[model samples]
Target: MKKKNDENVLATNRQARHNYEIEDTIEAGIELQGTEIKSVRAGKINLRDGYVSIKNGQANLSNVHISEYKQGNIYNHDPLRVRRLLLHKKELKRLAKEVDQDGMTIVPLKVYLKHGFAKVLIGVAKGKKNYDKRESLKQKELKRELQRNFKLNQF
Candidate 1:
């Protein structure tokens, strides 16, 4: 049986939008142990403080917390271990080049199950300045107010 979208989930980092401007996205496979996979299936993962770093020419996800499976007494995975992200050589090289540029970063946007396999959505982003963030907030508020006025006029 398949789990519902809302169920069998762990955690999500919603703060990515507030901190950075996402430029592009890529899906990468997460290398997991059997116990860790089970724990992820049960929705015991956290990607809030998670980040991807290049080490020895490879990408590794750090600070991503995958909680220990309750049923696995002896073979449970560590909750805060670094997990490898699978990507093609070409993609890896591209990401590496982009990250080498100033203000560019790699952020894991979301972790979800696809076709019974766990997948992560990673975004290449640039940090937004304080003025940029404030402008975005102002635009959002103006849009909301316009919507509200439109709805009131309709009624």
Candidate 2:
């Protein structure tokens, strides 16, 4: 009963990796309406500006945009409504504790389908400083150069 293949990724937030150091990742289910799932299947979603916040002891994902379904009727949901995340109570509490600490936040890394259900991969991340970003970039460039040199030597 799966709509998307296991390898199909609906959306990803590359900026999350660039801006944050992800210490832990967790997969959680999402609450979506009928039209929302259609939109998600069509790959009409953005996770770049989305974040999960704990409110009233509940985890709510906000600012994630799921475009309106083209064939949706009047019952279509609001494109930017806050969606609830399905996670165990203990997990939620653990996340809350981490997020409560200084410089720790929750961010959505990607969205995909798992076993016919919409799932989101979230990360417990700490923000990277400007110098850290530059250092990471330098390391990436060095790795690329090493790979290129290796390929040329093999030829």
Candidate 3:
């Protein structure tokens, strides 16, 4: 059996890094039903294609899939429902302005339990062009090669 970490990370969207250039991040509380939280703790959550949107001064999380709990039976929540994100009004306004003016969008980076409350780490990010993605891959390869060479020299 796999051991769960004390840190309690439910899901992480590593692909967000490859697809977007994140500029700012904030922690926001997510509204979840009992079964939804159960599914999250069991690590059946996916944020790979998830995104955030602000409508009517409220932030909403979309496309973040939390699989139904096996034991939930009739109490299971929808796997792909749009969940409400709780944030300060001031923060919402600021995010809305930046998104409108900068053409950036919000994306969930990771979800975890904090102080027994489910929190999501979200970022304001601009989508990367194809060329930008390729360049990032090239830079990552260079960094890996440098690290490998340094380890060899230390031997």
The model with the greatest lDDT is: 2
Steric collisions counted per model:
2, 0, 0
Cα lDDT, model 2, residue 104: 96
Per-prediction TM-score: 0.88, 0.94, 0.94
Error of 1 at 103 (Å): 1.0
Cα error, residue 99 of model 3, in Å, equals 0.8
Model 1 residue 110 CA deviation in Å: 0.3
Better of 2 and 3 by lDDT: 2
Q: In the order shown, what is each candidate's alpha-carbon RMSD?
A: 3.0, 2.8, 3.0
Say which prediction, candidate 1 or candidate 2, comes out ahead on TM-score.
Answer: 2
RMSD over all Cα atoms, model 3: 3.0
Model 3: per-residue Cα lDDT over 8-101, one tens digit each: 7888999999999999999999999999998998889999999999999899999999999999989889999999999999999999998996
Can you write out model 2's per-residue Cα lDDT over 10-59, one digit (the tens) per residue? 89999999999999999999999999999998899999999999988789
User: 134 in model 3: Cα distance from truth in Å?
Assistant: 0.7
lDDT of each: 0.87, 0.94, 0.93
Superposed Cα deviation of residue 59, candidate 1 (Å): 1.2
